[model samples]
Target: MTSNVNIDAHQHYWDPARGDYGWLTPDMPPLYRAFGPGDLAPLRTAAGVQRTVVVQAAPTVEETRYLLDLARGDDSIAGVVGWVPLDSLDAASILDELAREPKFKAVRPMLQDLPDDTWIAHAPREDAIERLIDLDLAFDALIFARHVPSLIEFVERYPNLRVVVDHGAKPPIRDGIDAGWQPWADGIAQLAKLPQKLHCKLSGLATEARKNWTEETLKPYVAHLLEHFGAARLMWGSDWPVLNMNGDYAAWHGAARNLTSHLENAEQDAIFGANARAFYRL
Candidate 1:
């Protein structure tokens, strides 16, 4: 029988005082405060979600450890997608250390913020990356649509590594389909065709579109992901606090459920939970 385990495959909890979150400035009052497991428990329970994969919001080793510490104390946290300076000499060693923590399921570099769009495609420190694959850890590509092409190249070099494109590579929903859909759609289609084990998240779209955006505004993009990756490879994520930038946890969760309602029950089950469990071994 198909398992009824519902998972929010992506989300984050950050304490800005750690000072690693350079992006969380006083200007963004909504996200400037600390967010933790306690803040999320009620919301997830209210939504009927039993577990979540808390991802990294900062590009620092300290932050990764903080997330792990939180995981150690919270059963609701299924896994963590932390960060490692991929180019550092100690990358592999750090991976080994983090891997010792069972909940350190993956690492995600903040690629979208970098000026070099192709950095991920040709990142150095193969030993570290290979070590990650050997340790059976996953890689989360935190990138934008422009990085998709290079991401394809990067994935080609590491076919054995499990990877997932966060936020459908942050599609240009705010720019509207006519202005930004073709390249993103085409690039995603190509990435989906690669023989590598690749996946996409049904997360962050709420924040990508305009604040007033509705589910219909997300229909074409969601449909594109479903068409390319299929429900089995597409996992749902709340993107939480950041999701609060444009909407709330309940709003995005409800929207995702409605968006995937047409699929068969099992397919819906996979997108909502099973795919993440299988991908992260959670």
Candidate 2:
């Protein structure tokens, strides 16, 4: 019973009939299956999540349009961080088209597989990120710890872009070791100096820890980012369907509450929803 109105900032919805999630396969049940707003509503209600910011799961503009259409019809979905080909010659035009839709709040490029140091250095993609900045679209940085230095460079290069570090830069929780993250954490600390930066979806720590993670187990990672970014620079995100890979929505929320139990009510409120509302203009 936290009284703060919760906003699940990092959930996703997809339809197999609309497009194929090549990422989904027979090995991954539950998540490998289709999920739409309807599947999410009950979970959110039960977890006391009043609003949500739907994020892109697929790498297609059609997926963005589909999520935007869902957000249009669903008040509970407060905003959407959709996808577009950032390298496309008409990237600005595509972003302009998405901007016309009220719920289209941000965009993300799936950069997890790219090499840590040189991925963003790729000319066309760098230009694309620059375009997003010009358009006032927030970029959700989705990379592993190895990419931290490069991400730091990207942030410095685009000071105007509102960058959200997804999953606390997705620390290595599975191995129960964070020493690998010290350099990454230091890099984030440097990036935090930027006025517009923030972090998201405190939900993945369990998977990263890949142990029987309790609040104590997640404290080092959560507390590290919370300290660096402070409440104003932090936001809550369910990372929903992916969170399903670790546990259900309620379970993730419980873990988050436990980890932040020491914070004052207002601070908790900021991480839970208020920051997301203001960040996305939801």
Candidate 3:
């Protein structure tokens, strides 16, 4: 409804036949359905979102290539943050391959499902992250509350690597739980000292909170990130098909706009799109 240009910082487009999305089950009817760029265009236009950064939902390079190809065919997708085996010995070569495509903006390792204490412990993952930095690629930390400490350590060690905390560290809000989120908030505050190296997406809170979360229910989490990271380092995201777990594209977009209603026009512009554009180099 506002005049500010919007950008969806965190959204996904997937094809089940191409990759394994074991997470999407029949019980999850809304998300188990198909989604594509054509499906997103009307939503984008209705939400006033001029551009989007398509993120990878799968766990393989072939999936990454698929997202890149989608970006190649869709100009509305300003950039793409896909997956790559950061622990692989050929990590640098994979980076080289993706670098050829300007739309390939960053990489994410699905660490949320990994064991609490894995090889990404400290030493090995730190080295791998450094290699990512050497190649000038950004890293998206997709972890839950238990993994926040490791994420903090990684960000501290690789101060130069651009790290965006997806889903506000995926807080357990649906259960009305905030105890586990306090430490995550503390970790984000500490990482915020690195400025551009740290950013956060104001998405996913709706699904995390009550199923039909109104603006009031989702305000606290959004306010926390806005206060901690500020609009300059914060970006708006639809979370798309994942958001379908709670509601549709209109619901998510409406929630986002409602949360930012109190901000100034310029501040809203930064959070809605400008920050994402600058962060992903779109």
Candidate 4:
């Protein structure tokens, strides 16, 4: 918890040649190319980011292994949030296989792409969450605002679950609409009430915003997260590579730093690094 330590708790690196990313289309030039530790190393260094938690982008377990392999060679990567098949009854074995990897701290099932919003609550899925809890693995929720209610319910179902809502649950930033704001805020506040278990990441906000976004336009939404989650539960992440679609790593980190410059240095330390270290045992 030293003041100077900094960790980017969420980021991604993918090579289409290694595993297919169904969502990664050729038109998206920013993401079409492969990214690895070499690309991120200097960006983080310039931004004073000393450690990172690389989360998964592709749904395949092969991709998870790909990332684990990358982590095996990269010391800056403290841990990883890789994917696993939560719908199948064999989830326990898959988790067992994954947990054998020392840096595997969590699982993100890619709920946003699925048709059923409450899929996490159905059948073997709930059992899968219990497995995650039993194995001491965190659950990274890659959801949108619409999934907020079910996400809240899912978390409530497991009091011991450690949850981090990726991308502010993906607010309605593209249209600059406030209609989704209230529900997102309300659900987030409800989740934040689970002080010990629930956490939020300050990331992927710019991409959700309009193509030409500014800190002022994003301040209202970011501030609300800071308000409810507090410094200890709020972690700053570049969401790098994906962040390249909206802005560069340095710009995103600079914006996050500026957004919270009003807070005390210790609180800044938590948002920028300490919280991530404690949350993921990084």
Candidate 5:
């Protein structure tokens, strides 16, 4: 992976008017409206971000197509992590069609939203998964701590499928470390030990923590990831707009930088950008 190629590995663009974003309702003010490349361009410029990977906000194929269309006209967009109908018999064909687009770098099922925690583990989508491997696309596991064990099993089932744990499995830091750290920590530690194409994003920690969260508050969790996955397998992401719920893009980016200050410059660079570029093939 190349160094200093700064990228925001995870973020999203959604227009609530599309009516496809079920979770993004009017109650979530400040973020209930549309967010697009125009809104993010200044943030990226201020942070010196050369490019970004736009992950899907809605679970619909139409939303995925919407993101791909957004990427096509936006130079700062490095690639996209879109959704797939994993249960469909035409899953392979769908992936094949999406892969034909240059910026379609990965697929992410909203695993956390699904009722079954072990869906990925036992899902009858081997053909689609195998096709993903053949196409060199990655998997973005949007999960929580409860979903980690199942994710581990899924990764074990297909050791070669590139997988990244978005938001460090979303540890319950808002409840404080002592309250729920052990379960998330233990599960994540096990995930890191897997001998496969696995990685984790150092993003969304702020939103998961108390609204008044600081760098010190996030240190232990970030340290655990760095200790286990190392800089090479961990990537930085803004998790923007949703980040507006607790903090802004600059604030999150600054906190991540400070949290990783102890690392060597090169290692920091890898966590900040190169690892993401390599993982997403951006």
Candidate 6:
């Protein structure tokens, strides 16, 4: 029988009252409200996405617990990439406390929003990074182009920690895919060298492209990822409410399918589900 195990390796939900989502302010009307299971269920069904790994939209242990509570009630939500104060000395203790919930799968520190791109690879966070390996938890790098260099170093140092670069480091689609981004492209290739430890998500592109995006506009970046990371390390994700700001869930999934139509059935399946199941341990 079929079940809700077809994994969308990345997605997110947030209630403004529960966490401090500074980026999700009143200015972004589309993402300024609450997004929950009920809001996403129909879209999931339509796209044949049965399960999802809910990522953190803010940087607080409080929000992580809040998301774990939601997963406790929703089986479709197979796991969570929750948040914790990475720089805090108490990070390991906090992770130990959160591990009480089996659905807690990974930790993301909102690296993209941080002022210093190398914050994750800095000396102060080394203890916490090793603790993740000891606890059998993952490190989800929510980073941007500038942070990819640090990401490479972080993965190399802790070769055992399962590190995933969220949204392919959020490439600048709004600026048009051009030659200026050769370094980002090179960084992706560098991360790819750590095949056994690194993973990437096919998500969050829609919002980055905004009104100027098209299927053709996104193909090159998708191809770039596929060329470096290949199908086995890539996983599909809706990016949900954030996706809603630019386009609907089904539309993004459709766009993803359209972009990768050249791949065989097995490769497509890896991108859509199987790889996620293995990576997230769903």
Per-candidate TM equals: 0.98, 0.90, 0.91, 0.95, 0.98, 0.94
Preferred candidate (lDDT higher): 3 or 6: 6
Report how far off residue 188 is in candidate 4 (Å). Answer: 2.0
Clash pairs for candidate 2: 173-208, 173-209, 174-208
Q: For model 1, how does the per-residue alpha-carbon lDDT over 108-134 read when each residue is reduced to its tens digit?
A: 999998879899877758998899899
Q: Scored by CA lDDT, what does every candidate get? A: 0.91, 0.76, 0.78, 0.85, 0.91, 0.82
How close to the true structure is residue 182 of candidate 4, measured as C-alpha lDDT?
Answer: 64
Alpha carbon deviation, residue 192, candidate 4 (Å): 1.8
Candidate 4 lDDT, 105-214, residue by residue in tens: 99998999998988776644666778888889998988877787787777777889888989878887776656657667777777788635689999889878877688
lDDT of 6 by residue, 25-123 (tens): 888888888889999999899988888899988787888888999999998998899988878889888888998888888888888778887877774
Candidate 6's TM-score reads 0.94
Q: Write the per-residue lDDT of candidate 3 for residues 202-258, one digit (tens) a residue.
A: 877776776777777777778778888887788888898788778777887887887
- In model 3, state the lDDT of residue 174: 70
Worst lDDT window (10 residues) for model 4? 119-128
- Residue 50 of candidate 2: its Cα lDDT? 92
Span of ten consecutive residues with least summed lDDT in model 5: 1-10
C-alpha RMSD for every candidate: 1.3, 2.8, 2.7, 1.7, 1.1, 1.9
lDDT of 5 at 116: 88
Query: Relative to the unseen true structure, what is the C-alpha lDDT of residue 106 in candidate 3, on a scale of 0 to 100?
Result: 91
Instruction: Compare candidates 2 and 4 on TM-score and give the better one.
Output: 4
- What does the lDDT come to for candidate 4? 0.85
State the displacement of the C-alpha of residue 276, model 5, in Å, after optimal TM-score superposition.
Answer: 0.7
